[model samples]
Structures are given as structure tokens and as C-alpha cells.
Target: MSQTKIGALQIGSALSSSKVTIQKVLDYESQIKDEACELIVLPEALIGGYPKGWDFGTRIGYRKEVGREQFLHYWNQTVNLQTDDLKDIRQMAKRTQTNLIIGVIEKVRSSLYCTTAFISNQGELNGVHRKLMPTASERLIWAQGDGSTMPLIKTENLKAGSVICWENYMPLLRSHMYSKDLNLWCASTVDDREIWQASMRHIAYEGRMFLISACQYLGSPSSLGFDTEWPDDKELIRGGSVIVSPMGEVLAGPIYGEEKLLSAEINLDDVIKARYDFDASGHYSRPDIFKLNVDQEERIKN
Candidate 1:
């Protein structure tokens, strides 16, 4: 079987403006494509940067009306499903003939969601997945996503799936992907080094699927004042993007402290080979004794 070249674009903060950040993402796309990567995965909320709760203080400083106006301006300034910026990314993807999995802040009517979008090499917009649950301070800004938006996209080359940030910690969510027979699992996160690496290892071994884990390391202090000063010298993300094989091998990177494009040629057959010994949701799981049901549709319906 032919191998697939998958990549993780570990990016630094890009909070300047929608246009500028979009350009940055596009530039990185060009760099990755030149390296012959078939798929490129970016960090969470890459278009707007992480922990946008910092902007709230700026919003409060203005008069009530001014604050409202400024809030509207910034809110409108964020990226979404239909933004022209995405069109640029789509066009680039078509030009390079490389699939892209991007994380963006999606604006839907009056509300915002932490969302991930998949685009084909031909620039076709695939389905999107929003964060099922926004953790802690994130709840202040993003609306929790419903189950209806959850997706598992099948391409000619791979049956792929994704979940945002903390959702990787959800066992049932991972099981849902496993039930779908997913071969490639994309996890976009904003977690620290230890938790991020541990989670990647756990998912690869547990699911017995290839994992492309991309995390943003925004050095910006928690907007909720968790820290007195930014932990790092510069308020930049310390990247921890990696690719793990089915056997829990670290294939590419857990590259830290820099923006980079890490790539690896992964053989799809490894998934089946690993499963030959044991599949967590299959032979390894004694369902007759204990079963986990994930009524995703019902959860969202309520």
C-alpha cells in the first residue's frame, strides 16, 4: 500500500488582525506543500490566536456604548465558515492539491464557537466540528457545540476524524471515533507539554490508530488572571505538535518552543496490523460484560 504524507504545522501566535493572520496561515501552507505533505493540520483557533478572553478587558475599558461598539467590531473581525480568508486557504489547497484541517473561531449569527474545518485538496469545504465542551475560562466566550455538528469524514485515502482540545480526554468521544473505524485521528489542542504528550500516547495506544496531534502553546497569560505575568518571555505559543503511530511510536514530533512543519510518511496498513493483536473497542473490550453507549444524537437533541 502507498504511504500518506501527513503534516502538523506548529504555529506561533497570530492575533494581529484577521487579514494578517490569514496571510500567515497561507504562507505556512505554501511551505508545507513544498515539502510534499498530503495533509496539513494546524493549531486550535489559529486564525485569531488563543485565550481571546484577554480582549474582554480591552472591551470593558471603553464606555458602555463604546464597549459595545468595539465588541461588535472585534467580534465581526474574527474568522468564520464563510470568510474570504478561508477562500484564500481553499484556493491555496487546490493549487497545492493538499488537504487542510484548520482550527478557527467560527462566528455564527450572534454567537461564536471554537470550530475545526476540513477542506479537500480541490478546495471543497468538508464538514466542521465544534468544541463539544469549552473548558473553564473558554466557557466565557464560546458556546458549547451540539452533537449534530460532529463529523467523521471519509476521503479516498483515509477515513479521518477530529476532536478539539480537551475533548481528547473524553473516553466516550474517542470510542465514538473508534466505532466509526477511523484510521486517522486529528486532535487540535491548547494543552501543555506533559498533558498533551500523555494524551497523544494514550489515544494512539488505546484506539490503535494513527494520531496527528497539534497543540497551540500561547504564552499569553490566562485572561482570567491565573498568572501574574506571562509564563514565557514572549507571549507566544510553545508548540507540541506530533504524529503517533498505531503501536504508540512517536513517528514525527513533539517539537516545542518554535513554529515548524513536521511531516512523516505513514503507512496506512499499520493500523490493521496493530489491530490484529488487539482492538480496544473490539476484541480487547468484553462488551457482554461491560458496554459504553454514546447516544450522541440524543445528547445534542436535548
Candidate 2:
């Protein structure tokens, strides 16, 4: 597996419903068929929606009745893994012969998790990686994930895995993922800040892996009818989707204020070449001096 083509689809969820978003994804997959991407990564929370400025009506110490109602509505918006219509998504992947890594709000009983689903080219749901630590306010809505769901998917073409959104900031987590000898690192995120690009490049250079960061592009606030104080003309989440080479070179984009699919052809040889001087998990790691311990226990059993 010397070279392969991968793509990152940057688009926001339909504010109306998950079904609409699912259709949007299916339509995009059809349009990109000619691009011939072996692997496609969709933005985080694409199925369930990101809920940009909503606070869920919560504050310190007191949880209001309105908050509870708001929470209930949000919970209803989550994807039920056992009952939801994921067949279409899987079938789409098979039709295109493209592997997919997509983010969705997963509902497990009463709990909701920010999860990334991995779909193989055969249209099988291979595995899912839940966001271990839901950043800041996200903790209020999403339950923290245990390590039991961490997945490193090995395909005939490449060894791939994902770190959702801000998880890229965790040094120890990066070490754990790097130890798996991954060639492709996928990041499904909604963080559209300029600083986020730097982190993507840094991680690619640090891990000596091809990195794909897919971000959401929520257009003008008024379009979504979101209840927020920001001006109606302002963009909610401007996209910054991008792809980076093992050497931290920008291969695809950091396209902003628009929705687009960015693709890059990666040569696996570059991973080895970039690591010749520094392999974070191999030669460069002084095991005698430092070590990392990971707990893979399931926090909640269904």
C-alpha cells in the first residue's frame, strides 16, 4: 500500500432533523463518486447536529425546569444505534467502495455519547470510538467515554484510527494511538478556529502519520434558525477542513466559510521517511525513562 486517496467532507447537519442530514450525506457521497476516494471522513456531529450556541438552559448549582425540557429535546435528537436507519449510510459506503469514518451523537439507553463510526468498504460497521472526554460544556450533555471503545482499524490499504476533536490535545492519548503504528489519523471535529489547523499539522508531524481533519461549515446563523445573540449574517461554524502529510505539509485545505470536500493522495512511504529521525512511539521513545498506562475498562455496561 504505497499510495491511497482519502477525502474529508466538510458540511453541517440539517438543523431540522437527523434524517435530513443522513440524506444530505448520501447525496454528497453520490456527487463525490467520481473523485474515487478510498476513504472518506465526515465532520463531527454530522448526523445528530452540533447544537452550536445552546447552553441547554444550564448554569452553576441550579438546573432549571426549562433546562430539563431542553435536555429531553436534545436527547431525542440522538442516533439510536440499534434502531436508527444506518443501513443507508452503510449501503452508500459499499456502493462507492469507500471506507467511512463518520461522527454521530449515539444514544445508549438514557446516555448520549459523541461517537465516530467506522464503516468498512463492504458496508459493515467495523467499530466506533466515543469521545473520551467531552470538552467543557459538552460534559453537561454527553457522558464521558471509557477506553473500551477505542478502536484501531486495520485495512488492506492502511492502519487507521481516529481522535475526535480536542482529543488531539492529549499527549498521552496521542502516544497510545501512535503505538498502534497507524498510517492514517482521522479527526472528526467542529472546531473551526485557525489554531485548530496548527494542531492538525503538529500532530501529523509528531506522529509521522497522514492526518485528515474534517470540520463543519454551518452557514449564516439565520439559515438554521438557531436562537442566538450573534448577528444573522454571521457564520456559525466556518469550516477549516484539511489534510496534512507525515512531514506536516498541507496537502488539501483549510477552506473556510464554505462547504467542500477536500481530498489528498498520500504516499505511505512518507510516513517511514518522516520517522527516520524521529518515531515518537519507536526509537525516539525512551521506554526506560518514561511510560504510559491506559485503562480500557468499560465505564457503563449495557
Candidate 3:
């Protein structure tokens, strides 16, 4: 593994529009075709719209009919794991000659999992990483992921692994990937705050791996066709997508308030050099003092 170019996609929210969002993704990919980004990452739930303000009417401690209806609509808007929609995405990655890590709301019967699909350069779906835990109100809409799908996927030159949104804060999950000797760490998130950005830097510094934190730069609700309570002055999600080096240096950007393509050149040797003294999962481990047990079996869907 030598030097590689990685880029993060910081785009606006598409609401419930998967087709349009995917088209925009392809368009952006085309725009950066010349940049030759070996690894391209998109924000969390890019295909299946990230609902920013739906409470699902659980405030009364009961599921309301209106909330059920909203759930139905959100469910209808999502793409199934086994479908032509995903097939098309794989084809696009193959055509662009680049590996992709895209966040999407994956449909499994009546449940939706916040997931990121890993597509290799050969245009094949490598695997998917579902969010292990949905934060706060997200629990109302998304389901918890099982451990079976949390393995590191090896690409041509990069050992890739992903953790959606707040799960990046999970020390055990980070250790799991670190144990695998990950070269590329993808944090597909909806968080746009400075705290999230800080986590990216810390993860890069801790793991000694290239980190790509992809976050959305969404605008007002009127444009994306969502019902909201916040004023126009407030942003739904200000993009802060960034690419950090193994030494935790900001190599690309922490772009915000706008849509942009953030790119950076990464040297695999740097990862090696950075790990010479501190390898979180390597010689730095204390297996006798700490143990992490994981379940890598895919959860059986009923």
C-alpha cells in the first residue's frame, strides 16, 4: 500500500428522495473522477433520507396513528438490501473505478437499520455495517445492529471499517477495528458539531489510521420537503466532513454551511510510521487486563 487519495462527500439532505440523492452522488463522483479518490465516503443515510424532526408521536407514551403513518412513509422511502437500487449503486462504483462507503437506511421487513454499504472498485458489494445502537430519538425509528457485521473489509490497498455516527464513541467498536489493523476508518455520521470533529481527530491519533468523517450539509426544511419547527437561521445539519491523517492532522477539511468535495492525499507509510511507537490494538494492548468479546454473526431477520 502506497499513497492514496481519499475524499469526503458533503452534500445536502435529499429528504425522502433516494433516486435524486443517488443521482447527485453519481454526479459528484463524475466531477471528481480526475482526482482519483481511491476511497470516497458519503454522509450517513444518504440514500434513505435522514428524518431530522419527526418525533413519531411518542410523547404521550403511546404510538399514535399519525406516527404510524409517518413510519410507513419513511419505510416506503428506504431501499431494500437486496434490490435494483443497490445494484445500480454498485454499477456506478464499478464505472467510476473507485471504492465507496455510502450511508443508507436499510429496510428489513418493517424495521430500518442505519447502515453504510462498502463497495469495492470491482463494483461488487463487499459488506454493510449497521449502527449498533441508535441514539435518543433515533431509537424510535431505527433498530440496534448485531455484532456479526462488524468486521474489517479489505480492499485492494486499504483495510476498511466503518462505524455510523455516534458509535464512533464506542471504545469497544473502535478497538475491534483497531485489532484488525484497519488502514482506512470511515465514520459515516449525521453529527456536525465540533465534538464530532474532535472525535475524528482523536480516532486518527489513537488508531494510527487514515480517518474519513462524512457528514451532511443540509439546508432548511422547505427545500428538502420536511416538516420542521426550527427557524431558517438554524441549519438542520451543517457539514463538517473531514479527512484526518494517521498523526491526527487535518489533511482535508471540516467544511460547513455549504456543500463541497474534501479530498486529501494519504501515504500508507505514514500509518506505519505513526504506529511505530503507539499501536492501540497491537503491542499497546493489555489483553490480560481488558477483554472485548464480539459477535460477528449476522442477525437472523424474522
Q: Which one is best on lDDT?
A: 2
RMSD of 1: 4.2
Error of 1 at 5 (Å): 0.9
Each model's lDDT: 0.77, 0.89, 0.86
Candidate 2 has its poorest 10 consecutive residues by lDDT at 76-85
Candidate 1 lDDT tens digits, 1-302: 45888888887445556677678777775576687777778788876567433434333334455545645665665676765658988898888888888888888777778888898988988878889899876775688887777788876677788889889888888777787788888988777557779889889988898899887755545432333345534544567899999988999989887667888899999998999988977888788897676545623221
lDDT per residue (tens digit) for residues 64-138 in model 2: 898899888878777877764588999988888888999999998899999999989899999889899999999
- Model 3: per-residue Cα lDDT at residue 117: 90
Tell me the number of clashing residue pairs for each predicted model. Answer: 2, 0, 2
RMSD of each: 4.2, 1.1, 1.4
Better of 1 and 3 by lDDT: 3
Q: How far does residue 284 in candidate 3 sit from its true spot (Å)?
A: 1.1
lDDT of 3 by residue, 18-86 (tens): 888887777775766777888889899888878888887668557888988888888887888776777
Best TM-score goes to which candidate? 2
Cα error of candidate 2 at position 195, Å: 0.6
